[model samples]
Every structure is written in C-alpha cells, then in structure tokens.
Target: MTIYRELVIHLKEETMKDIELLVIYQNAKTLLFHDSKQTNTIEDFVTGCIHHYIDRVKHQIDLSGINDLGKPYRLQNHLKEYIDKKGISQAMLAERTGIGASNLSLIMKNKNQPSLDYFFRIWIALECPPLDKILYRVEE
Candidate 1:
C-alpha cells in the first residue's frame, strides 16, 4: 500500500548541513518516488521533491508570503538521537564521516553549522536511507 507523507526539511544557519543529505525514508519502499525515478544523488532527491510539489500544485497548499522570499525555517536536530540509537560512538562516526568529533559535538549541541558539501559526506559515510525521527520541519 502507498502512504502519503509530508517532509519539511528546514536547514537553518544553526544546523548541520550534512544532516540534510540523509535519505531517511522510513515510509514506503518506493522512496522519493517522483515519477518512479530512483534518486541516485541528493540533488536528484531534492529535485524530485520539487517536481512532486509542482505536479501537485492543484492540491491547494498554504503558500502564505511565499513570494516575500522569507528566511528558512528552523530545523530540529535529531542526529544525536539517531547516533545514540544506532549505538555508534562519536569517534567512530567522525572516523567514518571524516567530520571530526569536535565538529560533530558542536553539531549535536547545535553550535556549529557546516556547509552543504558535508551533507553528502555524512550521507555517504553513514549509509543511512531513512529519516523519520532523524529530521523534521519546525515552522518558526
């Protein structure tokens, strides 16, 4: 059976960019199934999501002040929780992701915000393809 899920990824300046690339699709087997295209890369997945929105434009979404070019929404950091549940140590994660334990710590504490490049690195290293509680949209 197919289920409809809404994902709002709000990457703020105070959040880790790498966390955005996590292809966490804890829903259906057809992850990001925009036209049944498998998103081989983060760009593809993102583009698929955009295309999905465009395809469903007639669904009537609340685009209040969308043309105002508003700032991005605040993101809820759940990487630490994800890591804890995975039973992976920060040192091990740093080694696997090459992101440095200190930087990882800052991200967990919501201190440092890295660039977009790190997203792919983290996603690739962690090999995680599920999001669910790993991230969510926090409309501020």
Candidate 2:
C-alpha cells in the first residue's frame, strides 16, 4: 500500500485531529506534489500524511534510551547506536561541529568523556532531542 493509506490507518487507529493531519499531509504534499498532476487523489493525500508520520516516528524512535544511560560505558553504547542510525560520518560531524574526529572516536569507544561544550556541539549536529534527555551523569 502507498504511504498515504498507511498514514490513514494510523490516524484512524490513533484518532488524530484533522488539522494536525492536514498540516503533516501538506508537508509531504509539498515535497512530492508535481505540476503535472491533474488533481490530488485520496492516495496522494494519504501518501503525504504517511510520509510525514513516518518521519516523525523515525525521529521519536531515534531518541529512545537517550535518558537511560546508567554508566559511562552505556553512554558510549548509546552514542554508537545514535551515530550509526544517523548515518553521520565522524569526520563530517567533527567538521560541522568544530570538534576533532579523534576526540569523538575516543568518546564513542568509551576511552574518554566529553565536556559539556563538546556534548552540546554533538547534540546540535545530530539534531537529536534535548541534550539533557540524551545525557546521563555517571554515579559515583
């Protein structure tokens, strides 16, 4: 089935608001809408909505376990998972955030702990949820 049908099913299951659905549906439509198209069909509308919902779901799932780091080691694992999912190369992230790839690599490998500034830069580059939600302090 198309993305729109999937979104309609999800919306029906969750009973989402029409306005909310319209806003999300429009974003997808804007991306996929073509001047060659004659009219917007139900399938097209539904596809747009589904695409938007999928994007939102991906972002939300990406933030999972961000607040559950109990140890420095666990934090490193979380970072690794995030980096893998985000498809961000260490060198690219470092360049974008003005940090050294070696430092990011060390942090991901659990050999080093990043300072707040470094963490903030990484967070911004990843666009990952709130920094506090993604970070945990190790207990003594």
Candidate 3:
C-alpha cells in the first residue's frame, strides 16, 4: 500500500479509540488529560494527529534511501485574501465562525497565529472554501 493510504487508515483507527495521557510541555505538564469535550478542541487535536502521522511518514521515506520529501505544509496568513474573495467583512466572519472579532482582527493583522480549531471554524464559516491558493498541499 502507498504510504499515504497507510497513514490515513492508521489515523482513522486511532481516532476511534479513547485516548488518555499526560503531556509534558516546556516546563510544566498537563495532568491526566483524557481528551476534550469541545468539538473545536477535539478537531484541533485530530488535525494535530494527522500532521504527526504525515511527518513520521515523510521521515520514514527520507530514511529509506529515497529522494527528499521536502517540508511539511505550513499555512501563511491568507485571511485577507479569503475575505476579499468571499466579499465578507472580518466582523461577519467572526460572527459566523463564533470567533471573537478582536481575535479575527489580530489574525488579519498577523498579530497572532490561529490554532487549528480557529482555522477550521473559519473554513466552515466560509462554506468550506478551497485552500488551493491558501495552503501548501504537500504530495508524496
């Protein structure tokens, strides 16, 4: 099977299980975390897991005497572009997505990076807008 296919299957299986763990951060640790109840948090965590899987696959491909697979996909700020293209004001987007207007302002101004949860909310608010011009679609 292709690496990408295998990775997708693995993630789907993992997502079905209840996960509990302790995460150690920079200097502190979150104690006995057993996932989140919020949809955004759960989606964000699942997105992170997908990213982790992709990275591991890429690293494996690299170590197997193959050509370099290049870097993981990273999102640049494209809120303004999307807003203009969709003909929506930042306030409207904020209201639709339930993200704070102030936070949306910060995102547009590049003052803050958005979490996956926030980004997904924006994407859904925009009626599942295409990211072809917004994010890198890394291919194997």
Candidate 4:
C-alpha cells in the first residue's frame, strides 16, 4: 500500500471540520498549508476542501524501498483560460507583468514553473483572481 490512498470524506457545510489541508501554490510543485489556523479567507478554506475531493485516486508504486505514492499529482493551472475569457491579450499581459511573452506563454501552458516573483506579478495583473480559480490540484 501507498503512504497515501483514496478516501472519500463527506462533511456538512453548516460547520467546519478540523481536517488538515495542503494546497499547491500556483503552478509550483510546493504545497502550502491551508488549514483552519492559517487560512484568512473563505476562498482558501473552501479550496482546501476541494483539493481533498480531487485527490481521490492516489495509489502505490514500487520504489524507495517503502510506501511509494508515485507522482500522481499534476500541476493544473487556468492562466490561458482566464486570459482568453477576460479578453486579455498576451502582449498586454506581458507588458503588465514586465515578463516576456514567451515566458508568460510557458507559464500559461503549465510547461514551466514561474518564479515566485513572476507568479505573483501575473496573479496581481489578473486583478487578483481567486487562487483556487487560477490553480488547482488534479490526481491521476
């Protein structure tokens, strides 16, 4: 068995649960804590729960001489979707972020991970869209 396995937990909406939550920061592979003690916004709390729902199919892989969960996690982002939906051109975004068009293209396609500086510049340029809306975790 893997260190992490599938578990479907149902919680009532009227109250909060004391569950631990981990979230991916933007397109970066780093995980951020989004538990009750740290989250300041409803969006963070809700998205933490959403990540739990999405992480429903993790399994074992042979490696590491122990419980190997494997790389079932993928960085999913909607930068291009938001840009297109908002009718924001790539050139305009580049100008707003002061990043090159090619770099922005790489970030949008999830082909490359942007620096923390570049990530926030792009996020802020987009009018501070909810972090969850722009990025999410998908387990495969």
Q: Write model 3 residue lDDT over 1-140, tens digit each, in one string.
A: 65533234344544454432212231133222544332334445556777988966665432221233464533356677778887999988988889998888888776676789998998888787445434332333
The window of 10 residues in a row where model 2 has the poorest summed lDDT is: 2-11
For each candidate in turn, the TM-score is 0.45, 0.44, 0.43, 0.48
Give the per-residue lDDT digits (tens) of candidate 1, residues 1-140. Answer: 99868777766754434534454452224554544645355555666778877766655434433334465655545677777877878788788888877888887665655456665666565675344435444456
Q: What does candidate 1 score on TM?
A: 0.45
> Once superposed on the true structure, which residue ranges of model 3 sit more than 4 Å away at CA?
1-74, 136-140
Which has the greatest lDDT?
Answer: 4
How far does residue 33 in candidate 4 sit from its true spot (Å)?
37
Candidate 3: the clashing residue pairs are: none
Better of 2 and 4 by lDDT: 4
Distance (Å) between predicted and true CA of 4, model 4? Answer: 48
What's the lDDT for residue 28 in model 4?
A: 28
lDDT winner between 1 and 2, please give it.
Answer: 2
Cα RMSD, model 3: 13.5
Per model, how many backbone clashes are there?
Answer: 4, 2, 0, 0
**lDDT string, candidate 2, 1-140, tens digits:** 65522222444644546645775666567667753334455556666776878977675543234455653333433565677777877888789889887888987776887888987788888885544444544433
- The whole-model lDDT of each prediction reads 0.61, 0.65, 0.61, 0.69
What is the descending TM-score order?
4, 1, 2, 3
Error of 2 at 106 (Å): 0.6
Task: Give one digit per residue, the lDDT tens place, for model 4 in 1-140.
Answer: 66855656566654443332323232122224333343234455556667765653342222322233465655567899999999999899999999999999998888887888998999999998766567755565
